[model samples]
Target: MNMKRLLTVVLAVVLSTAFVIAQEKTVDGPVITFESDSKDFGDIKQGDKVENVFKFENTGKAPLIISNVAATCGCTVPSWPKEPIAPGKKAEIKVSFNSAGKMGKQNSVVRIYSNASEPIEKVSLISNVLPK
Candidate 1:
């Protein structure tokens, strides 16, 4: 009888652990999934600035908070929504690529810090610039 009780307890513990692990597998925060991971401007002219808006969805169970957004260089500027994105809601990130003093194939990244389970998300932009 004692051996049977011990086996049952072990089985219960194993089941509990498995349940916890399965829950942890899902993302816990903003879940900032984007429509596209990268954008290509194709061709641009020097001395001109190009802007693109990235669309994203909050696919998590909780409110998604974008703590910060950073650019790869000073020539790239990014603007993200300041408000919390509720579950199933959408948001946008506006990026401006400055071409002054820059040419050739230009690639930049936007690092996003969020209060989500992943904590960090990266989006990239690429373009080719020629002299005007």
Candidate 2:
């Protein structure tokens, strides 16, 4: 082949190989798989406290490390496992809602930060608070 054609082929091959390598590297992290992304409390009475558990599993090659869990408001609180979740293992995040002064329709969000492929996941909580 001509020198110019040979150099062009070589450059293309090098770029394709580099891209493949980068994609493989990015896919090596843990993946989070949640059973459900939203929970409905249906109807709750005012001043009542309720809790729900969000289940998830690590479905990737690496261990899942959850860094933090945050709630959208003070009335909602979330708790998660402090240790790393191994591949194919399951975990749970507990969310508690205190309907102290809340009334009417309520919606809350819980943000989870982790070392997984997505890095962050959001779960939603919904309820219709009835007057006491």
Range of the 10 consecutive residues with the lowest summed lDDT in candidate 1: 24-33
Local accuracy by lDDT, each model: 0.90, 0.93
- In order of appearance, the predictions have TM-scores of 0.79, 0.79
Worst 10 residues of 2 by lDDT: 20-29
Clashing pairs in 1: none
Stretches of candidate 1 off by over 4 Å are 1-24
lDDT of 2: 0.93
Model 1, 1-132: lDDT tens digits are 999999999999999999999887666656888998789998899988888899999999899989899998999999998999999999999998988998899999999999887898988889999999
In order, how many clashes per candidate? 0, 0
